[model samples]
Each structure stands twice: as C-alpha cells, then as structure tokens.
Target: DQIILLKDGRIAETGHFEDLMAAGQTFCQLISEYAVTHRGQDGSGSSSGADSDNAETQSQDMVGSGTGGDTAAAGTTPTSRDTRAKDAKKDAKKDKKAGIIQAENILDGGLSASIFLRYLRAITYKYATLIMLFQVLMQVCYVGTSLWLKYWIGQNEDTSPESRPSLSLFLSVFSGLTLVYVLMGIVLFWVAFGVARIRASEYLHRIFMSRIMRLPPAFFDTTPLGRIINRVSSDFASIDDRIPWKLFEAIGHAVSLVASLTVVAFTTPLFLVASPFIALIYYYVQKHYQRASQAVKRICRATQSPIFQHFQETLAGVSTIRAMNLQGRFIATSAERSDLYSNSFIALAYGIRWMEILVQMVNVVITLLASLWFVLLPQGSVNAATAGLALSFAMSNSQSLIWFARTYSDLYVHMIAVERVQEYAELRTEAPLSTAPDSETGRALEHHWPQEGRI
Candidate 1:
C-alpha cells in the first residue's frame, strides 16, 4: 500500500512498494539487496524481481502480524528491531526471577558433628590434641591452686604445730603452681589456639579461593560480588578472631564449671541430691536459649551480607546514581537493610539478657540451697575450711555458668562461618585446568609449540 524510506535521518522516498520498484531508486535497490543476500533461503534461483516481490509479501505479513492491521497497509516489517525488543523483555523477566544477588543460604537444626570434624581436620589432629592437653593442664593447675589454699587454711587451724607444713615450703609451692598455671594459659591462648586458628583459616581460605577461581562464569553472573566479599571479609574475620576466642573460652569455662561442681559435691555431700535436678534445669535453659540464639545469629549474619552487597553496589554506581538523582532512594534502601540487621542484633541481645536472668535465678537458687544446707548441718559435721571452699565455689559458679552457656552458644554460632567456608571449599569445581591430551599428537606437542603468531 505505502512505502517509506529514510536516509540520514530524513525521508528519502514515500510511495506504494510497486510504484517505488517501478521508480528503480533507493527503495528498489534496498529490496534487491535483501533478496540477493537471502537468495540461499529462497532456494528458487529466481530473478531479483521475483525475490523482491516475495520479500515484499513477507514484510507485509510480518508488519500485519506485529500491528494486527491490514497486511496491505502495514508498511515495513522492522523484524530485527521487533526481535531485539522481545529478547530484551524476556531477559528482564529472567533476571528479575533469578536475582543477581542470591539470598544467603541458612542451615537449619543444630550444628552438625561433621562441621566440628571439618574444622578439626583443617587445624590438624596433632594441634587439636595439643590444645586439649594444654587446656586440661591449665584447668588442673587452677583447681590444684584452689585446693592448696584450702589445705593451707586447714593447716593453720590445726592445734598440733609439729604436723603443719612449713610456711616457706607452702608459699614456694603455691607460687610455683601459680606461675605454671599462668604459663599454661599463655601457651594455650597464644600458641595452641593461635597456631591452630591461623592454620585452619589459611587452609579454608585457600580452598575456598581455589574453588571460586575455578568456578564457571555462570556462577558469578548469578552470585553477587558483595556476597563473595562478605564470605572472604566478614566470615573469615569471624573465623580468624571471634571463633577462636569463643571456642577457647567455651572450653575453659566448661572445664572450670566441672571443677566447681566437683568441689561443691566433695565439700557438701547432701547437696549431691539436688545436683542432678540443677543440671537438668541448666541443660534445658541452655538448649532453648541456644536454639533461639543461633537462629538470631543466622539472621544477623544473613542481613549483614545484604548490607555489604548494597554498600558495594552503591559505591560502584555512585556516579550513575548521582547523575540519575537517585541518591535518596539508594540511601533509603540502605537504611532499610541496616535497620533489618539492627533489629536482628537487638533480638540477639534480648535473648542474651533472657538467658542471663534465667541463669542468675538458677545460680541464686543453688547458692541459697547450699547456704541452707550448711546452716542446718550438725555442729562439727562440716569443717570450716571445706565449707568456706564450697561457698566460694558456689558463688563463683554463677559467673562461670553464665559464661559457659554464652561461650558455648557463641562457639556454635561462629562455626557457621566454617560451615559456609567448607561449603565453598567442597564445591564442584570446573573441569581440571589441564586435562589429559586428546591423542598421541596432542601428547607429543611441545610445551611452547604454539609460537607467537602461529595461529
């Protein structure tokens, strides 16, 4: 019906296709070029005139289909432009569905034994054994020093001076044990835990990096650079610093708790009757608190990744955002992410406070029971030294118990970083960097056979 052609941003020709063809100008030349380029597709070996007619009919059909208009009046098809628009829409939908930054994955249930084993393997069995041994030695010296104090008090109270140990000897032995205990603690923290943490961090980081480097490009397309950065920066920092300290403190507190309980039981035999019930209460409290604590910690950590992702994106697109005048929108979005993280952190703090109150109540109950037992006991049934030691340990148990639960929960929560690191470390990497040669010829090729410019 009508034909229009533009050249250099101005209309060059306008008429019916037949009239334009008859004119034998720009429109006709364009039709002839198209037909010649697609000659193989037509497969008829027709003259350019016939092919041009076929092309005109195809254009009419395409334009009519696209616009839902009369075929004769629709004009040119614009096939390439239409195809590109359709493709762009499809890509947009796909990208919206499969987001560039994936949500952080969280594992449910309690920390697995496998994760512990993985960490132990990373640190090596030798270092782990040494760490355990040093911890035990440190605890022994601590408990022994306390017991020696009880013994010294007993000797001072004795009416028979001949049986009493020399004061100089007692002081020297006590001082020597104190020195040994301090030395053991120093070594345990700086040497055993330090070296083990460093080694584990290095091993996990290396494998994680190796796997990431070998991963296919498609992985990066879907995974945000910020998510990767979060793993390497925040997660590894926790592993390097927070985790080691949490683990060491957890173990130390646990050992100290056991020692306190043992001393309490020894000095106060009747208290043993209620120890089981007290332990059961502590177990349930820790169990429920730990579950909520870990969940909140996961939420806290997950929200952190989004913040980091957003921050990185904002930094990268700062100029673009400024140009678009979208700084306020980005800042609002960042504030929202930070608020989410802050809310999770607040929940975690509430959980800790709840645990503290409950644990303190339990400790008070324990101390009250111990005091009642001592006051009610028959005269001379319990000696002053043993009773004083029991009271001191019972009082100290409050702090020890709370620290034990806190450190234990923290240790497991921090282990999440290890789990994540190990997940990447064990990921299915891309095919080997250098595969076996294809055949004899490939095997025989020289290492530097591909000389410069040979291809």
Candidate 2:
C-alpha cells in the first residue's frame, strides 16, 4: 500500500501513517483536531439521543418490524411475529417497486412534434375513430341548436295561423334541442374527462416513473430528491388533475368556435366580409400570447425545482443544522429560494392576466360591433331577436377563446414535465456492466491507496 498527500496542488507528504506522523507536525495536529471534534460530537449525540429515545421509539419500532425487534418487542409486541413478517414484506415490496425500472421507458431525442404526438397517442390513439365520430355528432348537435333557435323564433312573427308552429310542435322542438345539448355535454364529459384524461395521466406517470428508475446514479447525484419528487408529484398533479380537462375542453370549445362563427356569419352578413381580418387578428394574438406564456411557464417550472430541492435538503439535515447552530441561516436560505420561485410565478400570473385583459377588450369590441350594426343600420329584418342571437354567439365564442388560450398554456407546461422526465430518462447510460477488470490501473485503484486519509 502507498499514500500520496497533497497541499495546494503540490505533494506535501507521501508515506505510511506512522511514517507521516513521525515526519509531519501539521498532519499530526490536524488529526488531533479531528479527534476532538469527533469526541465532542459523540458525547453530545449520546446525551441528546437518550432524551429522544422514548419519544422516537414507536417510529423506530415500526420501521424495525420483523427485524431484530429489540425495541418493538419491548412494548409493541411479543408474539405478533406473523403480522410483523407481513408488514416487513409489504414495506420491502413497496420500496422495491419504487426503485425498479421497466424496459418500456425509452425515449427518442428532444420534445419534437413526434415526441409530443407519441405522448398524445398514448392517451388518445385508442379512441381516435370513436372520438372523431362522437365529436362530429356533438358538433352537429351543437350547431343544430342555432338553427333550431332561428326556427323557434319564427313563431313570434305574424303569419298565417296554420303556417305557425302548433303548441305541441313548439314543445317538441324545444325539448329535442334541450335533450340533444344535455346528451352532448354528458357524453363529452364522460369520454373526454372520465376515460381519456384519467387513463392518460396514469400512463404518463407510469412512463415517467419507469424512466426515473432507469436513470443513472449520477443523475440523482446532481439532482435533489425534493426536486425529483416535485416533478413527479406536484407537476404531475397539475397535469393529471387539471391540464387534461383544459386540453379536452379546449378542443370542445374549438368546435363551439366554428359553430358560433357560422351562426354569426349567417345572421350578420356584414361580419362575413370582416371575418378574415378578425381571424387574422385572433391568429396573431394567439401566437404572440402562446409564445410569451409558454416561455413564462417554463421559467416558473425551472424555478420551482430549486424551491423543492432546497426545502428537502434543509428538512433532511435539520438535526445536523441545529447541531451546527445554523437554524437562522437555513431558514433564510429556504425563504430566499421560496421568494425566487414566487417571483417567477407572480410574473407568470401577471402576464396571463394582462393577456386576459387584452382578450376581454377584443370581446367587448366584438359585442359592440354586433350591437351597433343592429341598432344604427336597422337593415331589413335585423330585429332584436336576430341581433341578440348574434351577440350571444359572440359572447360564447369569446369566453371559449379565453379558456382555449389558458388551456393551451396548461398543456404546454404539462408537456414540459414530460420533457423533463425524458431529460433524465435519455441520459447517456454508463457502459454495460463490466464482467472483467477494466485495465492495468484497476488493480492499483482497488488497493487502499490512501493509507492515512481520504483525498
């Protein structure tokens, strides 16, 4: 065995421990200082542990079940050996499952459209044909409502009595439209939310976790468990719980937008001429807002990782922190991290709110135009009913537009989570497990080269 010691990048000593001690005064003094520190720590730790043992005993006993059971057997149980065995096995199974990696988590490259499509396919590919057919039926019914309204209003116009709809006809038409709408809503909710969203979230989690398990140890070495946990738990929570609904509903609203635009174009022919300009404005606004919001959301997500990481580190080392009397320092650090995360979130929120204000102003303009044409021009048959119907569609579509934008943002952020998971999953793996000694230097490396100290 041999030892090589360095100071300031230059060799200070290279010898066995006894030889070093005989030759180096500084090394002996450093060793003595460490010994004193260790003794102090051991003495304080024993005394503090004595006070905590009784209070912490139950927790320790629970964790130690089916092991020696030295603490547990004293008070928790004596003959409940089978129960302990079952519990021990269950815990082991859980821990093992948590760490095990499946072969299914492989990913390709970056978050390209193909990757995004792959993700969507995992959620929706099975339902493609059915979903399309169902949505068509729903949109037809949704659009049909406006047509039905036009007919229903015709009853109020003065006409031949026989030509007018009878009481039964009116009731039947109203009931039919209501029934159709209710059915559309129910079916969309069940299929879009109940089936697709829930299953997609679960599959995403499986993929994310499987990938995490397969990641190299070096990935975890640099990343904090808290940050890792935040990505899987809270970020996944947002995607699983809300973002899917946002996406599904956004799609549903797109159908509504088409239907609304169709009605508006038919009732107010003038709007048809202006529709292209309106659409161009919408496209531009949506593109600009999406870019800005997505970028802000990414910033927020990045900032959130560190908050969780710092909090986890602090909690894990609280005892050591207290021993070192660094409570104020750690608390300040946690607060600083929290503040940084909050600034990003606050900025994101303000940006979305600003966009909302802009969208609402546009909606007001739409409503005003619809109303002003009906009031001022008094074009033939541009009655209150016609004006009101057009205005109502305008309002509905505006709300749908707002929600669609918000949902798009949600979708973007959630996809970022999947992308982050892929980041870990796609890390270049260490070469396949070695079966033979690596090289000539392996033998020397295996020996205890540092005879006196760690480098």
Candidate 3:
C-alpha cells in the first residue's frame, strides 16, 4: 500500500510503490538502480519485471497484515528489515530497563569484619596464624637490635673499664639480632606472605569461576557481558596483583609504627605525654580521609564498567554502525563514557593527594613535638644514648607514619575488589547437572530409554 524512501536521514518519498515509480522520484531511482545491478545475473527483462511486481505486492501485503508468510511467498521480502528494526527497538527498551551495566556497589561505613574474615578463610587459619607469628618475631628482633645498639653505645661511654662490655661482645650481639631480624623478614615476606596471597587468590578465583559457571541464565540476561568481564579482569587483577602487596606493606608499616612508638616511649617517657593527642589527630585525619577516598574510589570503579560495556557494544555493532554511517556518533559516545571514568579517576587522585598532605602535616607535628620534648628535658634525666635512640626513632617515624597511612588506605581500597569477587562467588547456583537414580525424575527414565539414542 505504501513505500517510504529515506535520503540523507529524511523521508524523501512516501506513497504506493506504483505511484512512486510513476513519480520517477527517489524511490523510483533506487528501484531502477537495483534492477540495473541485478539485470545481468537475473538474465531476463521479463523476470526483472516479475521481481518488481512481486516486491510491490509483498510491500502491499506487508503494509496490510505485517505477516512473514505472505512476504516469504514473494521470494524477496523487505519485511525482514522491519522485523530487524522492531527487534532493535525491543532491545533498546530492554537495555533501558536492565541498564547496559549494573552499577557497582559501594559498601557503607568501614569495611566489615566479614571481608577480612573471608580473605583469611581463603588463606586458611593455619597459614594466617603462622604469618602473624613470624611478623611478631620480626618485630621483636627489630626492637632487640635497637635496644642492643643503645646498650653498646652506653657501654662505650662508661669511664670505668670494669663496667664496660667488650667491643667484640657488642658487635656479636648486634650482628646476631640484625641477622635474626633479616631472617624473620625473609620468612615472613618471601614464604609466609607469598604463600598466603597465592592461596587466597587461587581459592577466590576458583569460587568465583564455579559460581559463575552454575549461575542461572537470567543472571546473564540482566547483567551485561562487560560487567562480568570487568569483574574477572580488572577486579581480579587488583586481588591477584595489587592487594597482596598493599596488604603486606600495610601490615609491615603498622607493625613498624607500633614498635617505633614503643621504643620512643621506653627511651623518652615524656613523649608518652603527647601520645594520646597524636593518636587522636591521626584517628580523625584517617577517618575523614578514608570516608572520602573510599567513596571516590567506588565511583571510579563503578564508572569503569560502562566504558568496557560501550566498547563491547561498539565492536559488536561495528558493521551495522558503519553501514548506517554512525561511526562518528559511536566515537563521540565512547569519548563520553571514557570521560566519565576519567573524571572519577581524577577525583580519586585528588582525594589521595589531599590525604597525603594531611598525613604529612601530622607527621611534621609529631616530629616537631618529639624534638622539642627531647631538647627541653631536664639535664641527666635522659642519658645521651637513650636520648639519641629516641630522637633517631622519632625522626624515622615520619616515613613509617606516611607509609602506614598510604598502605592502609590502599589496602581497604583494594579490598573492594575482593568484596566484589566474593559477591559473585556466593551467588545462588542453578540445579545440579546430574540427578541420583533414586530421585523422582531419574526413576521415571529407563536404563536405555531411547533405544535408538534419540530424544
């Protein structure tokens, strides 16, 4: 009944095919060109005329009933294009309903204890305990080394030979403590930490894979492929490559900070007077920074999935897009998605820098307080050796504090990946592939139900 011809994204002709042909307009020109292109292969002018009549008749039938059978009988159906367009619209609606990718979740408050427990379970309690034990031993050796150095310095300053230890004895004890510290570090970092991280990675990955494989078809339908890819690729990359190191460094820095604080307190009791105030400052700074940083990181992570989803969509429709001359449009869309992710990432960077500046300022305050307390102390109340030890640890405390703050923040941020992986790992799986013979469905089947092996 009607023919609609589009030219330069606008309807150029709309009427009955016969009328459009009679008009000698855009539709007529297109038909003429198509006929000329097929004339050689079609071979007969009468056959071409028959094809044109069939096309017109099919178009009329399609306009009337919109059915496939009538169009199929015409031998060259244009209704497939309409069917495809309808399908595209339906998909667009579905995409709108389901969203291209589900938003990534950001957990509220501090990271729950369950996340840590889950990671520990992945590594197993035995390995976790062993790693902690090694860490404690390493810290003990480190403290012993510092104490021995202080003792050796005091002995050298003693004027009475009878009260002084020999240089050889000092050297032997110092070297032994240093060697033990190094050995403990090797065992903790190389053996314990490495094994634990590897086990956790393998276990989590296996669980994620198993659950994903057993997930129901509906899960995949609602969740975009790019979201799944992001989890398996970017999230797992953080778990496997980044989290372990951050966790190790965070633990190390925390332990070192504790040990240094202890040593400083032991050598200079006056420093303890300022400990509570310093701790309060640190707590507030960390709490404020962590809340902001975690939120920014979550946004950064969430925005990343759309970029992947958009890229996947673009690749999947590249051919159709090119045919429709939509390459520039797609490029612009890609840029928009990328910009969203980039903006979030930039915000995350700024948040990190803000945290770093605050942390460094706190460090400066600590160093300055320690130096003032030591210098203004009563004469002979603190020995030279003890004062020197406290000052040295105090000076080094800045690095330890900065690394502790940095690695601790990074550890929590990276744990978000593990949390995501754990979520997928615990998804409700579909029914088992095999059933027992005693079950109802299984019992109804014969041992050789299909004699010819056909369903």
By lDDT, is 1 or 2 better? 1
Model 2 lDDT, residue 163, Cα = 78
lDDT of 2 by residue, 324-378 (tens): 9999998898888788878878877887787677777777766666776677774
Off by over 4 Å in 1: 1-101, 161-163, 437-455
| Candidate achieving the largest TM-score | 1
Each prediction's TM-score against the native? 0.77, 0.67, 0.74
lDDT of each: 0.79, 0.64, 0.75
**What's the lDDT for candidate 2?**
0.64
- lDDT winner between candidates 2 and 3: 3
Instruction: By TM-score, rank the candidates, best first.
Output: 1, 3, 2
In the predicted model 3, the residue pairs found to clash are 1-60
The digit string of per-residue lDDT tens for model 1 on 117-169 reads 98888889988888888888888998898889988988888758888778999
* Alpha-carbon runs more than 4 Å astray in model 3: 1-109, 160-164, 436-455
TM-score: model 3 vs. ground truth: 0.74
